[model samples]
Target: MLVVEQLRKSFPTAQGPLPVLQGVDLCLARGSSLALMGESGSGKSTLLHLLAGLDCADSGSILIDGEPLDGRSESALARWRREGIGLVFQHYNLISSLNVAANLAFQARLAGRHDPQWLDYLTQQLGLMPLLQRYPEQLSGGQQQRVAIGRALAARPALLLADEPTGSLDEASSDEVLALMLQLVGEAGSSVLLVTHSPRLAARLQRRCVLHAGRVQAGPV
Candidate 1:
């Protein structure tokens, strides 16, 4: 489960401090999914980063399963991120030097949760079995994105944060990848907070929240 209370973040600008998120509050139950929809600059990605501990909130608390992340040291946060969070970005930030197989197993190995059977299952499910030996540059956009998703889920982290994961793919590929991701996340029993701009994509999830005026609208999702 994930919880956010009065989450506020501001970035320094030439003019002054520009607030992105102000007093935002949201929660997602364990094993559930929530789609975070917002326009550009609505702080969707900022919120996701805070949840992943990639960035610190100016003020507020982010709790994962009742553990607060506010006061953790960088070393502690890094360990927590490696072990507890799975992140998928739009760019498919794969290691170009590593082949698909290595990339798929990278995070799981780092988390010390590597399972060959599970990795094989993920490869099969993501339609990536044949491309395992290829590097990131050799695969199509969809294939590469699939590998990214596979890598994120390979470790079976408690929470998955996907930031516009399908933004680079065509509609058909986007639909395919998103559907597969949801199915696999369910199988892995991990909570998901997917940030996307598409209503069609957001609607597919069990719950949806729209960010506006620096805070999340609606209640529990």
Candidate 2:
């Protein structure tokens, strides 16, 4: 569902341009799950952002489904993201003013494809039914992360991009959340590209790729 070729990205630094990714190539099949493993400065998150079209790459090409991701304007990318991609971040990016239910339905409603049944199912699956009326501040870190995952899946996106999805949760909570996420993604028939640091977590995925020195290397466990 996603293909990236020779992807390269660099950022302006006080000293010079800081290169983050170089000649990174990856392919994710439809309805498959892949884990990206890397250390702190290895550009895993940057790669996710590039795949999601949240940031532009300095060079190379990205294709989602069959559409090219390069050369699109910011607005065009935003439109594509709304229609095709769902993102889950390390930090739960929930709106403080909105309750869990509203936050979950926000994107789906905006896309003019709100499915109440699906939303309800997601809430129950994420163990978020009781917290629907509560705001982000009222929930614990794990609860908030569940809500974020719910919100991302609520859109019924074709591609799910998750960056350190369990970074803020305890061990039990992380395992629960990750299991739910994998199950839901399969049920929804969506492809996943998850970035994580845990070998145990990475081992659960169908395929694994390690990012180092701005390149991707894939192999068996």
Candidate 3:
């Protein structure tokens, strides 16, 4: 459902415009998952940000289900971010003042697509019912990550963008979190584009692509 064509981006540097993503092409089918692997500075995060609409590519195009992603106004992109996509990061960006239940429901409420049934299902699957009243500070890393994943999937987003989602946890915690994440993503039927450096983690996804020298290539990074 996602297509990127010769996507190119560059950033300002002391020398000049330092190119990052150079003619990167990618495609993701609906409800499928893709792992983007790269060493440091390979522009994996940059490509993810561009697809997330948090940043724009300097040239080329990104299409989702035939709709062009380039040239949109800030407001339009903001709306798309709120309603059309779900995002998770290494850090759990939960609202400190909000408890687990509120945080889980936050995005869904914003999208005007809140579903009590879906939220309940997530709560049950994530084993979050007992922790519903707790805040982020009171939870463990795995617990926090679970809440983050639940919040992202609460809206049943067509796509989910995750960047180093399990970076903060220990090995066991990371494995557990990733497993739960993939299971919930399947239940939610959301397409995933995950940016991570771990090959073990990348292997769990349906497809893996490496970013090297600003271009996407098949196989390991």
On TM-score, the candidate that comes out on top is: 1
**lDDT: worst 10-residue window of model 1:** 212-221
Q: Residues 1-221, candidate 3, lDDT per residue (tens digit)?
A: 99999999999999999999999999999999999999999998899889889898899999989999899899989888998899999998999999999999999999998999999999999999999999999998888989999999999999999999999999888888898999999988899999998988999999999999999998742
Q: How do these models rank on lDDT, best leading?
A: 1, 3, 2
Count of backbone clashes for each model?
0, 0, 0
Kindly provide the TM-score of model 2 when superposed on the true structure, using C-alpha atoms.
0.97
Q: What is the lDDT of candidate 3?
A: 0.93
Per-residue lDDT of 74-113 in model 1, one digit per residue for the tens? 9999988899989999999999999999999999999999
TM-score of each candidate structure, all chains considered together: 0.98, 0.97, 0.97
lDDT of 1 at 172: 91
For model 2, the local distance difference test gives: 0.89
User: Which residue window of length 10 is worst by lDDT in model 3?
Assistant: 212-221
The residue pairs that clash in candidate 3, if any, are none
In the range 1-221, model 2's lDDT, one tens digit per residue, is: 89999999999999999999989999999999999998899999889888878889999999877789999898888887887888899898999999999999987876676899999999999989888899999999989988888888887888999999999888888888899999998887889999999888888899999999999998574
Off by over 4 Å in 2: none
Scored against the true structure, residue 199 in model 2 reaches a CA lDDT of 87
Better of 2 and 3 by lDDT: 3
Report how far residue 104 has shifted in candidate 3, in Å: 0.4
